[model samples]
Target: MKENIDLFTNLLEKKYGVWNRNKALFGTTPYGKVASDLSISSSQFSKLLYGTATEGMYERTLNNINRLIERQSIEKAYEETQLVINKSKTAYRKRIYFFSILFLGIGLITSYLFDFNHFAFKLSDYEKHPLKSYFYPESSMFFDSPFIYNNAISENCPCSGFEGKWKLSESFKLPLPGMKKPGLYYQAKSADMIIRCSNLFDSYIDKGHGMMGYEHLKSEIWIDTKQEPLVPQYFNPSSKVFTESFKQLNFESDPRFKKIADLAAFNVNMFKIHGDSITRNAELTGRLAIDVNKKLAKKYNIDIGYIVKNVLGDLIKASCKTTFNPFCNPNDLSEGISKISFDCVYTINEENLGLNEGYPYTKSYLFKDQVFSDYLPCECEDN
Candidate 1:
């Protein structure tokens, strides 16, 4: 392909010089003039250059080129090619000088209008109106220290490097391309704020994976006294609220996550309730796929199990779009219940979860799986 293109280009340069991709100084492109002479469309001539022309066009163009080469002697062709080369070099030098002057003039004017040290646009303004920096670069020097992070941590947070310059929560309101809305709206001095701003390491408090040593607040708190381990133990499920609520969570009807949920429920309950009795534990663990305490399965129905699975597995899968490491243990289940109730999945921004809008997970196998299909919508129909 390269050889074919090169042969065509070398021949073209010998006859008509380089094909100016931009406008020709006269009227039409050199390629266009040659294409017209050969009775082929400019596009067809281009295709021939890249060896992408149809068989008929390729043959016709080759025949025309052979005749064209034969019409002129090698010495004449060489002399004509030298003239075109000299002209092309002059034009190229003129373009370089023109651009250099244009850029220099623009830079000097920008510096004069808006001092480099004191830009008309503050980082705070850029934080609030992010696009202003790009559109009006003269005003907003967004690359500066404070403005470097378009979306920094909350102003209320002590760890927020920018001292009271910007609010992390405010980023949700801005209509930036890849910016995602926060899961929980943070209010100053509020429980949500305290919960969000307590983190010193990362910008936001991520679900399941928070920085070590930080007392990252969970949505639900464990019951002070342990009751029936099989029963739903977490109290105050509605303590945390999300900016957007989760909908269309078909846990029971969805077989994949349901099976995982049921197994998780059985495992947690069996571990907690029958851990003391080795014989009972082994028997119950074996029957994980089948059932767990038929009397309890019937009594409470699948509600407890569904809740267990929804929080630990379904919600986790939905929120962590990139990675799907679900927790099914009692502690994680309690946190999961909180996540489900507060709609935590939507509260955390997509950026916080390491999601790139340009490269989405909609087509990924994890997204296609029936378990997550309801949570993460796919671009194509499921197989």
Candidate 2:
């Protein structure tokens, strides 16, 4: 019994990278650390490492080690089999050369009359449609558009401007928690556009799709402003000199607008928009308003009520109109811009906002208001 226990201890030491001489001398301290690191219980580790017990525990530990050793042995056997097959093939080739020579005289007569090339003939037809032309009939010819190719871009690739230079526009700011200042800003101009988050552009470029749906649009915009503007220039036309708001700024509350506002508010929070004592509190309050408006819109599905109750009623009531400054007053002014810089304001005009130049500034039917022809693809059926 003692000998059997000793044999097991020796095997454990050898298999676990410990010398047989040191197995008995090294106590549970070293074993315990290894066990803890491996996330195994100390009792199981001690029994396996020390061989201090007998019965069921001993058998279990021995079986575990035996299974590991058996796996190694099986792998070694597979390697040996592959080696034997390689050697056998080499020997067979040597024998085949001698056998071929012995049958060479008879093979020459048989090969002369039988031509393999004639049996496998093909004709080149350049006039055929390029897609239909095939070198081999059995080969696959199915191909997909290069633009929507899935493997063309990697999904895990980081965003392009994530680490690049970005400047915040002055007029935009969202309130965020624990921020010393407003968030950073960035814009994606048509020529300057880079694929970063998703492959929407590739699909749009290939298929002539005007733009991806709202979901795609959602992922593309990333705002990191210190105080996300209550009314961003992109969304607000009243602040810009040249740009016009969607002709119907009725403020009649659409549920969709609340969702948009909520999304904007969440972005403000995540990016930490508020800068200091003056700017910080109002933006945060505004973000809360935005969030409340969103929840109310979602719950009631009546955005007009939400806008009236939350923004027009709740927010305006809490804010002091007397202290408001379009420039210095953080809460009163738009989040992204202080009143100082003119360029801080983003406008809808093609000249001011270089990003949306391709999009029409005015409605297609209202082109008489401006001389510029609609460059955006017309939805009209007739040319």
Candidate 3:
């Protein structure tokens, strides 16, 4: 445990140099605040930058300190990236006025044509034709990163400006009569990430089939940050990434069309999740969860997927293999958090390892790595 800290500190010192690292931690940061909270005379924060241990130290202690340091370190990096992404957005400020007027005009046309009454729009024109509908094959499993699951991630990784481990030392407690005991986390380390994405892609049947559907996939990636790992979450809580994406997506689409203009209005929900405060994420979570439930998908009107077709307009045949964030600390917002009690595993280091040992977090540490096979050729076809 402490040995890991030594390596972490060494990496930090190497990046800034001994003189500068000490000056940054001591001179820039308020000295005794963190140490006081832990009731230690010496700065436990020092363990972040200078302390050494010949072998691993206490498991719980290391996790507590490591998560703290992890947040402090990468939060700084994300702040830096935020700055870069911000400077980039200033260039797009001029285009907003031009699009605003264009949208108003298109909105008038779309509301008149695809009005609320057309909410039940008919495809009679297409159904009467021989092609009937264009069948959009399902999308292949997607990953924001270029590498396959379990591939080692680095600073160079795409879509993830992350590379660190997160550990929650103990279960939480409050000033209540029946507070839960602390949790022991022996297996928190940097490893593969399981990304639980919902409603990222929606597909609808076209022509006369008259059907709409939604789907979700649980993809895996290499390493994920301890702070925040959800790819869509990059926009959540509102970062410069959100604004850039807004502009890029609008600019990419041909907004001159009524369909495109109408979509722009609703698609903003995806953007809204990031714009709204984290506490408001309960709404977004409920919405995304519908992608998994067949009935809920119907109720919510979540039908939206890009359709592919051949020149004659038959749904292009494409092969797809099968596959499988949250808010708060995500741990706090997790289903597992609600189930915890004082007598659960938090009380005894090795108590009944309940259903969700790695709540708000993920898989425990083990020698054997969780693996996923690369996609192989398939004979999938359109029915």
- For residues 238-302, write the lDDT of model 2, one tens digit per residue: 43332234233222252223222322221110011111211111111121122223343344333
Off by over 4 Å in 3: 1-58, 72-77, 88-91, 96-371, 374-383
Tell how far residue 152 is off in model 2, in angstroms.
68
Global CA lDDT computed for model 3? 0.25
Q: Candidate 3 clashing pairs?
A: 1-56, 133-207, 170-183, 171-183, 217-324, 218-324, 236-274, 331-360
Best-fitting candidate, measured by lDDT?
Answer: 1
Winner on lDDT between 1 and 3 is 1
For all candidates in order, the CA lDDT equals: 0.30, 0.29, 0.25
Q: Model 1, stretches more than 4 Å misplaced?
A: 24-29, 74-383
Per-model RMSD to reference: 29.6, 30.3, 22.6
- Please, what are the lDDT tens digits per residue for candidate 3 over residues 1-383? 55566555443343333534544453233336534533344544565435543332332333334334444555789999988766765547556667888999988888787755354233211112111122121443442432223433221121111111112223221110011222111111122222221222111111111111111111111111122222253233333133333223221143321121010000001101121121000000111111122232233232222110111011001111111112212112222231111111211122312312212211221112111222222121233
Per-residue lDDT of candidate 1, residues 1-383 (tens digit): 66556656666665566656565411234666788766678788778876896654553454355435434554578899988767777779799789999999998998899864355233212222223233225654454432213244322222221111111121111001111221111111101111112222122222211211101111211111112221122112233221221223222343322121112111100011111110000011111112233443343233434333322222222221222222222122221121211111321123323222211111111110010111111111111
Among residues 3 or more apart in sequence or in different chains, the pairs in candidate 1 whose N, CA or C atoms overlap within 3 Å are: 121-139, 182-347, 183-346, 183-347, 183-348, 184-347
